[model samples]
Target: MKVYGVVAAFWLSLASATILQNGQVRPNDYPSTAISAISSYNSSWHTYSPGSPELSYKGRWDHKYISWWSAPGLKFGFQADQVAISFGKYTSDGVLVAYRLGGQDWMLTNVTANSTHLFVTPSTTGYNLTTPTNVTQTLELRVTNWAYGVQIQCVHISGGAAKLVKIPDYTRTMELIGDSLSAGQYATLEGISSYSWGLLYGLGNVEFSITAYPGICLHEGRCYSNLHGQTAQWLKIPDTSGRALDIYGSDLADIPNWDFAAHPAADITVINIGTNDNNTANNVTATGYYNSYIQLINEIHTRWPQSQIIVISLWSGFSQVGNTWQQGAGFLDEIQNVVKYFNNGSLNGRGECSSCFVYYFNTTGILEHSDIGPLYHPTDVGHVKLASHLMQYIKLTFGWILEQTGPEVQHDTLYWNDEADY
Candidate 1:
């Protein structure tokens, strides 16, 4: 597939127009002689660009890098025992990435500009991944934190691109839009702890893209940085760009306009925002929330008009005082109006509302009173609960059934341990 080149903006719209029929896992592509070498013993290395269709992007492609913690990064199969990749040519130093063969514990690597790294071999120190009997092995790469982004310049396979294999059987694409809760703030491997990741990891077949940023309000204002925040209606690049420039010292610019058509239009798009807007600090009026949300939904519909939109009311770790947990700010009530206004025709005095295929799920009391964590976000355990609840809702609402059970043991626990310092 000609995955790159923005010259023809036509394909961009088409990608967003393509939606998966139903949620389904990719069929496993195990050859009859699974363990047999697919190439001659004399292996020659070959390089392929990030847009090479040979790569299986389990994560969202910003058209340059696999971003956000929802699906974290990319994964692909290689016939060689070893591989090398330039994860970042434009990214600055000190960006950490974790990668491992399927069924292996994550191994960490730090990146600098245009750095090339080889897969850790079995005999190498600190290498704990299993050496499968099969020659073709799949490598899963993910960013270690949300404060930064990882870009793949090119990948070098030992044999050739001909040996590259798809991850197989993935049926649907979902774009997750939210604030810190979806960003996995305060949890280990932040994005991985989000409800979006929870749903994707639990369901197993859906490809997910996260549009979450910590501290962002749906109505927009100062959030993660002093510059601007990603609002429900005006988001193109995620708000993480602020963190990228401030904290990581990366040479990057906020993408002027995110290419909506870079990936297939989402089959399902979930919106979990409003915490920052209705909080006592922001106290953004209901009128502002209603108009902003109406515009956001209308914009999403225009891009992926056929996709289903799921809007979830906000949740939080309420502040505790005098042995009493304060009730939440009632953001869900306001969010419900956002949903109601869409289906009932735009009631917002703002111009208009596009026709929306939307559903509003009340997540007011999703977490146990005990599941809230610091920063008023869900704890690792609470994320599990939120993901589970949403998955059930999707299954019943869309008639989506799973072909396999997940998340494997690796996915269940934190990718980081106390011994390792990120």
Candidate 2:
């Protein structure tokens, strides 16, 4: 896996306050005031005040690709033409910003790391807003990039007068943990795992967190170093260094650990791992893998006592080590046995978690050789299929109300064609 470094750069200054599009320049203005990151409307993993407009930090390893902060049911008093956001970084693969205006569907746009200031208007470069103006409206924005950390300073509105209003309380909360698939490594255009799943589960009114990284494993160490050791232990930490601070290094202060109390405990925690552990290089035995996985689940239970642990079977095509798949069938069977053992109250190593369950998804149709590249990461279509299957399981298990007819379609014009396999 490639290590990411902090770039010392600044955003390009806007030549004009208003954006020019389709031969017309709209009037624009900076928000009269800003919302502090600590406000209830702004929900994130870490709270740090770097400067003005207190920032919310999202560590690189904690929720790289699919982590998001949203303000739902925000009522604007007057017509607002555009929204601007300020971030700490401005580079490539920076962040994907999606918003839902009023009662309409959600729309998506990309935010680069080169520019700390992001301006989104009806006549924005990539997407156009369809919600009617000059009326009370609600907006929600989600971050989609997973490579580096981001600190969202504040959200700004322009064009007309408006004020930030209270958002309704969410009924349920969720947390997702895994490796590259969950971190959205290859599927750059429209495949942040949590985004796809959020749409599938109709999670507009739910608060959620995604904790994952590329090439991380359950039993084996991280993709980069063997010293990292086990996904469970790493989950407790804050950031994983791509450079000086690693498992082998003696740098302790460089890497910081996370505080579990920063965010509220989730109602449901879905874990999708073991793909890297099943790799031929890891050489993990069935017994070792099972024991390590059970230990990880127990740790999760202990951390979030009220959460319902749902272990997802690894998707197919990830076990290809040589001419044939390495741990495709056998590893799945082992995982099933582990789940059964936990459910039957046989392996209660860490206190019994009665709500623990297993979800075995059929990945035959979703993970096709053509869909995934040589590295075995899922494409946008593959992610959508995975989300569909997981959505079915959530509906059957929790009986969540299906508000929409189908999954929300994302219209993204900025597609990444040359993403490197980590």
Best by lDDT: 1
1-422 in candidate 2: lDDT tens per residue?
11111110101211123333223563333222223333343332222222322222322223222122121111222235555554544223434454445544555544544233433456543333434244545555545444433444344555544333335445677777765667665453323443334442354455555665555567745444423444434444533323213222434444445567766677777777776666655566778889887787777777788777667666546444678543244377777776677677443433224455543443444555555543456655566666766666666666776554543444332346686875
Pairs of residues clashing in candidate 1: 16-265, 25-169, 26-168, 26-169, 26-170, 27-169
Q: How many residue pairs in model 2 have overlapping backbones?
A: 6
Residue lDDT tens for model 1, 1-422: 01112211321322231212123332322122111121342256567888877687655445556454333677887655456677565553555566767656555566556566766334433233434334556777776455566678887665322356666736787888876678765555566556677686567667767767665677756533313444532345434444344433432243435667766778988888776666545556888877778878888889898899888866545666787765454555567676667668443322124554788776656765577653355667788888888889888777788534532422435445677656
User: What shift in Å separates residue 384 of candidate 1 from its native position after superposition?
Assistant: 0.7
lDDT of each: 0.60, 0.48
Show pairs that collide, candidate 2. 64-146, 65-146, 90-113, 90-114, 91-113, 91-114
List the candidate 2 regions with Cα displacement exceeding 4 Å: 1-82, 89-118, 121-136, 188-204, 220-222, 225-234, 237-254, 318-327, 345-371, 404-422
